[model samples]
Target chain A: MTALAPLATLSRRRFQLTTRTPRELLVPLVTPMLFALVIAPALKEALHTGTAYEAFVAVGTVGLLVPLNTMFSGLSVIVDRENGAQRELLAAPVPRSFLVLGNLSVALAVTAFQVVALILFALARGIDFHTGAAGLGWFVGAGVLFAIGMYGMAETLANRVPKQEEYIARVPAIAIVPWFLAGALFPITALPGFLTWVARFLPLTHGLALMRYGLLGDASGLEHIWSMGSNTAMAALSLGVVAVFAAALTAVSIRVFARTALR
Target chain B: MIEVRQLRKVYPGDVEAVKGIDFEVAPGEIFGLLGPNGAGKSTTIGMLTTTIRPSGGSARVGGFDVAENPLAARRVSSVVFQEPVVDRSLSGRTNLELHARLWRVEPGVARQRIAELSDALGVADLLDRAVGDYSGGERRRLEIARALVSEPRVLFLDEPTVGLDPRIRHELLEVIGRLRAGTDLTILLTTHYLDEAERLCDRIAVMHEGRIVALDHPQRLRHELGRELVELHVRDDLPAALAVLRAHGIPAEDAFSVGSTLTVPLRDLSAGEAIATINDLGVATAISAREPTLDDVYLRLTGDRLAPAA
Candidate 1:
């Protein structure tokens, strides 16, 4: 059987579920701007950067919020399990992997929309760096990839975690701690020598750096440790790393969810 | 149609839920797995529905091996679990159409089938309202409509009337009874409700402690107790009553007591002979005669009362 039709239908349902509930959309849309307003000025003079700190915080906010909000979508799995909807869906004739993909795709699209809205919100808030349409396009791409990679990790947790209480207890370690270590609140170059090394390997580091490059037009200036090449080549390298992150984690999550969903 | 052979499921920590039971259901038949909670009725349904992996043996649904070809098996069958599964946030029509799409029913055909199934299930009037607004029985009707939207060949209902009030339960029963009158669908339902099994199933397999203790037409199973039961009440002296009956050629083993009443199976004895024998003994007691029921059949097969809960 063709997987396209069912995946599309399931994706549509996920999208419908998301839109019908406005609270899920709120964190992605409003929380980033709140961060730009509240945290950017406090760190403005403490850390010197090429762009205004508000601009830096704008990309950081988007970077952190996009993945965090998308990952939270995994909570739906637990809710469906409690309510018996998951059993109904599992008994359907569709391939199990398609269900994982459907969840991933809708998260990507919703976060992509959030990316655009956040950019416009930053502009309206008077945080200026890049005004080009192509830059906004790159921001959306980075947000989508960031969401994809993190959502994959979330699905793995959702399928494997036994209870909602346990899953929520783990959200900080899995989704939040990485952002702090990855320099979403600031630049990783400010971190200590050993902590900097730890930050270099995280997908969130590159994802946040890539998003800054797209919106701030300075490549976040945090890529020098891994690159001796020009800034453009550095940006391309960050994009490649984030793409690999998205693909690998998504593949693993689909496999894990397929086996774990059965009783 | 459904078939199972030597099916077993040993849960983690070595809890054997279903132990090598065998049965088959013909197409268009209303087969039942009757047992109280934890008797492995739900576990057997889980295996046949492809939600649970079988530890050993085999099961097939609509000719597809559940373990080897679960998706194919799922395509030809549907299940209504004991748990409430309909999405309460959405309207009944939306829920039905959503399920239709997941099963890849063509959009046009899905719409038509949604309409038909809702009308048939008596949920047509409530289709436009969100399911959260529905009563328990209404939501159940909508769930059944959603299961039927794909037009499955085999339908599994696991305790379909468990939580409903009596009036609503019988109402749902009538809905299912109507489905049983037709030959287009095969149904496998589980219920501890004796009267439901007695009224609905073409044949039932009475399960106890993970095995099929009895499998036959409901009437035949009840026949194990006898055509009718002779009820004997003694104010006191049950042993004397027993001795008196045994002296009249009715063995004490053939009669059992519940409270003050001693129930004697009226195998060949007419009510008059039993009454005359009691009079011959010059004993004072109250007596009555009644037909045997499925409750007696289950009690005879398994000493435990067939309760509704796990």
Candidate 2:
């Protein structure tokens, strides 16, 4: 099932383009860091409780910003389609899945770097994490799942939209609605009735809830056993949802790609 | 090596881009789908090359169904799109190498093929340079090189030289000819350039408004028209001479007229007979006999103007 050589070739192609200009990386990396360092601090007082304010913002920032890199990088897929390389790739003899997955791997790898940088910054800035190595592993794994999930949304929106500008305009609303409503910045406990009900379905709400539990030892809102497990449950559930989203998005993307190859 | 039957493609807006078009391309032959812009040449090529699905039709490329057996068809064919497909941020060799990988070429063989294709396409010197800085012609050549890396049984080029300079167009045409001479490749080219169809196509299929109007060899299409074109230059009464030709069963066309020059299609008369008949009419000035070209045949079948320009 592995077309290793083509995967390597696509990876190399992605790397070359990324490195050639390097300006493409500036937005994804810098935007997240800026959000983590400057925006989070400015908003911390308004959003945080008496204690664990820094840790709360750190965990939330990691979960929110980690997903965005993959989302941003997946925009390259649409650009490639516009330029006709996507057509060329689809028309090639390689297995259809590799084209998407191979490119998706590049997005994942790139965003992985950004996730690590964010984590290290949080640690250096005096954020705490309990459960030691176990918690830390869950944190990193959650970041990966977050990236994959957002990439799923990116693929779906990018394929469906008529223009990149339209996708750009809509992505923020999509990302922010889930992240903010999930209580990443504020507590979902204090939300209005309709908003609180809606927050239950947001994958980020569950994921961030778990992250906060892992890092700060504050298992607030652990109503069920899945919730009691906190970090493990969040990582498992989000990864599960992400796997399904990735698969469904990929299946739909393949259909869209085939329909559009000659257009 | 390619057969299309009753091929139809209708877009979402109820535009039928291909309406039951049928044609066959012989092995190792250069077949051209020629038409004006928006005549469904690209759509037909798209269908044949497995880039797009047919609404209700079947096309067998290299003896495999493009609809049901797309992978097999793709394995044996390569398409060079009308638009550029190279990754501009990557070097030329890297671009070709990516294509090579998609075709699943082994690493050692991919390396050798890339080298050979670059040398063949005359981009050996620029293999390591980014394609963004390359001129249009250079980029075009690089695309051709990328297409050749797979050495597929059939090659599809959709409007390969629509906006290129004459020199670059000629150069690209030469490269295509060389590919035929050097490899066992069945080339299918779609173009709006009548001259290009005349020069490169072993057989030409003329399409208009999503249907195959005529399909034949360039010379045969001309011969099939069974007419010689006559251009008459008159010092005065240009309209009168045109009227005379119309009255004589030969109508004057705009393609015939320039600086008191008027062209009349001598459809029913032989070239010598037409010239003698015109001389007897005393329309003034000289008459020049022209062999029927694809343009003449095109004008005859679809009228002088091209399908109202989409």
Displacement of residue A134 (Cα, Å) in model 2 is 3.9
How many Å off is the CA of A101 in candidate 2? 1.8
Which tens-of-lDDT digit does each residue in A1-263 have in candidate 2? 26477677666777666666565555667766776678777766666543366667677776667556666776777787776377788788766666666667777887777667787887776666665776665555555565666776777677778777887888778766677778776677778888878876776776676566555665563332144444455456655654565566667766655455445
TM-score of 2: 0.88
| lDDT value, residue A20 of candidate 1 | 73
Query: Which candidate's lDDT is highest?
Result: 1
Which ten contiguous residues of candidate 2 chain A have the minimum total lDDT? A221-230
Tell me the tens digit of each residue's lDDT in model 2 across B115-209: 88888888999999988888888998898888888888999999988678999989988887788885669999998788888988999999999
Cα lDDT, all candidates: 0.81, 0.74
How does candidate 1 fare on TM-score? 0.89
Candidate 1, CAPRI quality class derived from DockQ: medium
- Regions more than 4 Å wrong, model 1: A45-50, A130-141, A220-227, A230-240, B230-266, B269-289, B304-310
* Candidate 2 docking class: medium
Looking at model 2, the pairs that clash are: B256-B263
